[model samples]
Structures are given as C-alpha cells and as structure tokens.
Target: MSENILDIKDLRTSFFVEGNEIKAVDGVTFQVPKGKTLGIVGESGSGKSISALSVLQLIDDPGKIVGGSIRFKDEELTTAKTSRMRNIRGNEISMIFQEPMTSLNPVYTIGQQLREAYKIHQGLGKKEGTKRSIEMLELVGIPSPEKRVDQYPYELSGGMRQRVMIAMALACKPELLIADEPTTALDVTIQAQILELIKNLQEEIGMSVVMITHDLGVVAETCDYVAVMYCGKVVEFADVETLFENPRHPYTVGLLSSLPRHDIDQDELVPIKGNVPAPDEMPSGCRFAPRCPHASAICSELPELETQEDGNDVRCWIYTEQWDGEKGVKVYDNETTS
Candidate 1:
C-alpha cells in the first residue's frame, strides 16, 4: 500500500453557465499522506471547496469534473460508480462542511441524523444505532450526549452543532476526513477548542485530514504539509515550516505579508492589491500576472509548477532559468502597489 491515502493529479472541475465554461478547479494536484494533515489555503473563489466536493462526486447540475484523476487508496474516484461512491462516502471517507446548520436537517433530531450513518454503513438497527449515536456524541465532548441526541439542531449552540457534525462524520470511523472551514463561524475560544478537538480526534482515529481554510494561523497550527492555491490552481506546495519560513510563489508571499504579526512590529499590514479576476475573463497567461509585483514579459506565458532545488514546487517565472528580468530577484522583498 502507498503512504498517500488520497492523490489528486491534474484535476479539472468546471461549471457551464449560459453556454460559457468556468474552470473552477484547473489542473490541480496534491497528495494527503496517511495520518497527516494537508492544508489548502486561499482566498474565496480560489476553488478550494470545489476541489474537495469533486472528491466525493458531489458536483451538482451545471458543474462537472471535466478531467484529471482522484485516487483514493489506489482506487480511481472520478470513474467510480454511484454505488461504489455511496459505499465509500461516509464509511471510508467523510466531510464536515463549512456551515453546520445548513448541512444538518432541521426537522430530524441529532440522534436521527447520526444514526442514519450507522444504519447505512454498518447495518445497525435503530436501537443499536441510537446507542452508538450517543457514544459518538459523548466522544466528541458534547455536554450531555443522552439529552442532546434527542434535541434538534436549532436547539444547540453553534459550537455544539459543529460538534454534532464532527460526530456524524466520524460515526463510521472513516480513514480520511475533509474539514472545510470547520471553525469559520465560531468565536476565538470556540475556534481554538474546535481545532484542538479535531487534532485530538485525528490522533485517536489515525485518519488523514484535508483541512481547507483561508486562515494561515489555522494552517500553521494543524497542517504538516501546505498547498497555497490562487485563482483556480495550486501555485505553491511545501511543508508547513518551509512555506512559512521561505514562501517561493509571489502569491504566497503576498498572503503571508497581509497577515498581522505580533512577534514583529510592523507599520501596517501589506494587503495584496487588486481583485481576483472573473472566471470568464481569466488571463491567458499567468492568472496572477496582473497583480504580481515581479511580473515581466516572460509572465505573458504561464509557468509550469516545477520543483526547485529546495524540493518545493512553485509556479512562478522568477525561479526559472529563462526569467528575462534581473537574476535572483527577491520576490518577497518586492513591494506590491495598488
């Protein structure tokens, strides 16, 4: 068996609207090692969530997986039948969506929702399912699992509801878990608690995690590997320490510069200039060329994601030998203007 639990290569997912195609995830590739966390970080409209959705074959109408491969345990997921996907979805792989209230059915009690997973995956009856449901609720550290299981989603706090979502996703003890902005809606304390809970649970269950978030702090805290995405592609990929210490891609540098740092005194936060281009109006060359500080004539052509001497992958012209500009130009030091 391979060390990687999930491997995505050149994956493309697009949406057809008004006879035009929007490439939401354009030739994206990454790997998630077993019992480790991989953080996918980028701003909104960067295809972070779309890539995760494509893994479960959950793309709705007007959207489809156009090309590339999604391999889970050496099983090709893009061509997997509906029945096969159904068996894999909650039993071997699970996901916790951004919002808990919207994902959970309001009409059903939390117990009913949790029990359904056990019933479908393990063939457990109502009595046995309910018994396991309460145990799962307790495992996630819910205050009163016996009472909370019978209550509706609307009856619990946001943090509690999120815990219920985690419990539901883990009910089958999946080998892989995809957490999409799990702590986005919580307060600082609650967010910390939720992250800690996930880390503890991951250690307990020994599952690989794909953590999708825009927060760099979360990436630093939880991720072992990092993939910095921009627009619709992965611009940089490296281990968490290498990424923070020496980010190769200009977009990654811009993102790190924008973050507020208490360790070092700064005059102001350096925000990346300009808005993300519309999907239909994407640049023919490098997607970030319009906003990059080091963009040159060579940037008129898109650069391939190539490995550098340091063994990190970066999609930028500055690192290439054909770079027409000054040799060894410091992208991190270059100041971006509005």
Candidate 2:
C-alpha cells in the first residue's frame, strides 16, 4: 500500500439556504494515496464537488465545513489560518475546475494568469515567469505555446482553454491536484485528450490526484481507488477493480447498472430510481433507503461502513450480522460476483 497524501475523517460541510442548514457533505471519509488517483464518483448534488472544495478550505460564507478533520501530509487543514491556507493552495495543492471559460480570467492574457502562481509561490520575476508560463503550456500539449501565452482566454477554443487551466494548475508543481469534472464540458475526442493529458502529467510529476466525476468510464480509465457517494455520504470504498467487479452497496450497484457500455448489448438503460434526497428532507435512516429496492425494516436505521472479508468497506445492512442471510438486495449487472 502507498502512503496517503490526504486523509479526511468524518467531514461534514453544509450550506445555509433559506434559514435551513443543508448538509452538502455529511460524514464523508476517504484517503488519497501518494502518486495515485482516487476518484469520487457520484450523481449531481451528491456533494462530490463540495467535498473537494472542503479539502482546499475554499468553502465560502454561508457554506461551512461544520465538522471533521482534513489532514494533508499530516498537517491539519481544517484549522489552518487563512494566510497559511493561501500558501498551501497554489503551492502544494492546486485545482482545475469544471469550466475553464469561467475559471480563467478573461481580462488577462494566459501568460499573466499562469505567472501569478510562480510570482506568488516561487518569487519568479516577469521575464522568468513568462518563460516558465510558456513552458507549462507546451508541457500540457498546447501547440505554439509562445503565441498562445500572449493571447487571452477568449481567443482559445474550449479544449485549448481547458488545457490552459491544466497548465496553470500545474505551474507550481503541486503535490496534490484536485480536478473537479475536468472533462465535463469537452467533446468526446477532447475529453479523451484531456484525460490522457492529466494521466500522463500525473505519472510525470508523481502527484496524487482526487478526481471528482459522475462518469464511471472516467473512473475506470484513470482511478486506482474509487469512493461511491450518495446523499452526501460515502456508501462504498474500494480499489477500482474490486469496485467494478464486486460492488456491495445498493447505490454503487445502481450506478454501475446505469452505465452505457459498448461491450454489453442492452435495449434500455437502467437508471437509479428517485432523485438524490434534499439536504433538509433527508430520510430518517439510510439516505438511500427510499430508493433501495431491498430496503427492509432494519434499513430505517443508518448503517455504518463495515469492512468485508475481502477488505472493501460498504455501508449497507445487507452485509451485516443482522441481515440473517435471507434478505435479498437486487443488484443489477451482477453476473460475475464470486
């Protein structure tokens, strides 16, 4: 096993909307191993993005990380000072957001934005910063980096702008890279290129990555470990291969069943029933109980994440001693489980 670069325990982030405290990330715990990628897979509103933000201490006013600890390289981040956190953000941990068009400053040239990280963190002068900025763009596979650095974000195409975001994020050689839906806005071909770029860069720099995405295909292609989250909590945590092979949680099963596979011939896609529960309207017991096909009376009580004999952790009553071995949870696409 690799050493962990980030360890989060019982993280709970919430937002105050309309005088109601809504839990966006509730009791989430996971670890990203050094030089490896951990994918947090969940549907929209599953708190995947918020969990990543909480790690960087970027939760704004009205949205707070109410509880839990975030330890980055054994340093506690939840209590870190603003100045210290700022230093940590671009220097040690950088994030590539979903939309480069919005994340990149339209008013500034690409070179200016990229150089900011170097100037602040590394104290590079204008000439040296510009040289380094062009190098980064080239490193991320942006053709004609010399010309591109002088251009504004609007002058670039969507894929090129996204590449710029990656260049900026990696300018400081951060130890951890948090990419939240990095390929969400790109076309299929561009998405593949972006994903490959991130993977190659990760291997080159030896940095740990926390990939927040709803696409299972992306998870399979890039992740070493996987965390399946639902209704703001982690329902399943396992190695990527184990997760796709032997998913134990109902929500995980549902997500796998919903994937559109070219190898498998399916007449209809099987989507998970019901939408993610609203934070204020969370159910009394297991958050997924309402939509779980196998939910029983015992499901009225929340289940803890329990480690199975195979070492995967799953949060479901079906795997516990109280299950009595008779109750069945209908997991789809489960033809190969041992």
Candidate 3:
C-alpha cells in the first residue's frame, strides 16, 4: 500500500463563464501521507477550497475538474463513477466544509444529519444510526449529546455547530478527512479548542488530514507538511519545520513576514503588497512575479515546481542556476516592500 492516502498531480479545476474560463486551481499537485496532516495555506482565492472540493468530485455546474489526476488510495477519483464516489464519500473520505452555519441543513436535526452518514455508509437503521450519532456527538466533546442530537443546527452555538460538523464527518471513521477553514469565524479560545480537538481525533482515528486554512498559526500547530498556494498554484511545498525555518518562495516569505511573531518585537506586521489578481487577469509567467520584489527578466518566464537538494519543492526562479540576479539574494530583508 502507498504511504500517501491522497495524491493529486497537475490538478486543473476551472469555471466556464460567459466566453471566459476562470482557472481556480491550475496545475496543482500535492500528497497527504497516511496518519499525518498536510496544510494547504494561502490567502483567499488561492484555490485551497476548490482543490478540496475537486477531491470529492463535488464541482457544481459551470465548474469542473478539467484535468489532472486525483488518486485516493490508488483509486482514480477523477474517473470514478457516481456510484463509486457515493460509496467513497463519507465512507472512506469525508469533508468538514468552511462555514458550519451554512453547511448544515437548518431543517434537519443534528441527529438526522449525522445519522445519514451511518445509514448511507454502514447500512444502519434509524435507531442504530441515532445511537451512533449521539456517540459521535459525545466523542467530539459536545455536552448533552442526547439532547443536542434532537435540536436543529441554529439551536447550537457556533463552536457547537462546528463540533457537530466534525462529528458528522467522522461518523463513518473515514480514512481521510479534509477540513476547510474549520476555525474561520470562531474566537481564539474556540479556535484553539477546535484545532486541539482535530489533532486528538486524528490521533484516535489514525486518519490523514488535509487542513485548508489561511492562518499560518494553525499550520504551525497542526501540519506535518505545508503547501503554500498563491493565485491557483502551489508556489512552495516542504515539511512544516523547514517551511517555518526557511521558506523558499518569495510568496511564502511574504506570507511569513505578514504574521506577527511574539519571539521578535516588530513595530507592525509586514502585509504582502497588492491583492491577488483576478482569474482572467492572471500573469502569463510566474503568478507571483507581479508582486515579487525580486522579479526580473528570468521571472517573466514561468518557473517549474522543481525539487531542491533539501527535498523542498519551490516554484521560483531564485533557486535555479539560470537566476541572472545577484548571488545569495536574501528574500526577507526589511527594505523590500513586498
């Protein structure tokens, strides 16, 4: 068996609008090792959520997985039949979507929603499914699971609703779990709790996790490996330790520089200059070259995601021998605005 539970290569998901194609996830590739967490970190419109959605073949009308291989447990997901996908989703793999308030059906009770997974995946009857649902709720640290199960989604607090979402995703003991911005609107204490809960649950279930988030703090706390995405592409991929200690891509460095560090006293956070480009207005060359301070003539041509000697993958011209710029260029100097 392969060590990677999920492997995506050259993924290209796009939305066809009025005579225009918006490449949301363009030529993306990454892997999630079994029993470990991989963090897909980036700002908004980086295609983190789209990539996760493509894994479940959940792209709606006007949007599609146009190209690339999505292999889950060596099974080709892109070509998998609807029936096969139905069996796989929430059975072997499950996802906790971004907003719990909207993700959960308001009409359905918590137990009804949770029970659906058990019923569909395990062939459990209503009584058995309800029993399992309550257990899952309790497992996720939701107090008064028996009572909460019968309550509607709106009845629960934001944190509680988020817990319910987690419970539903884990009801079938899925081999892989994709958590998309699980801590988005929650407070700091709730965020910490949610992250801790996920880590504990991952340890207990022995499931590989793909954590999609913009928060670097969450990545540092939970990720084993990190893939930094920017404007629909992965600019840098490395182990969490290596990524934190030494980020290779200029985009990655800019992201790190934007974060406020307690260890070092800084006057203010260094925000990355310029917003992400529109899908249609994407740069022909390196996507980040427009905002990169080190961009030069070589950067005008796109760079491949090449592997370095240290096993880190970076999609930048600075690491290549063809870099015509000055030798030993420091990416994180205080002077560079970007």
Cα deviation of 73, candidate 2, in Å: 0.9
Candidate 3, residues 245-316: lDDT per residue as tens digits? Answer: 778899998888786543345566778899899887889999998899888898879999999999889999
lDDT of 3 at 193: 70
Residue 30, candidate 1: alpha-carbon lDDT: 91
Give the distance in Å from residue 293's predicted Cα in candidate 1 to where it truly belongs: 0.5
Show the lowest summed lDDT stretch of 10 residues, model 3. 259-268
lDDT for each candidate structure: 0.88, 0.86, 0.88
What candidate 1 gets wrong by more than 4 Å, as runs, is 118-145, 157-159, 260-267, 333-338
TM-score of every model versus the real structure? 0.91, 0.90, 0.91
Clash pairs (backbone) in predicted model 2 = none
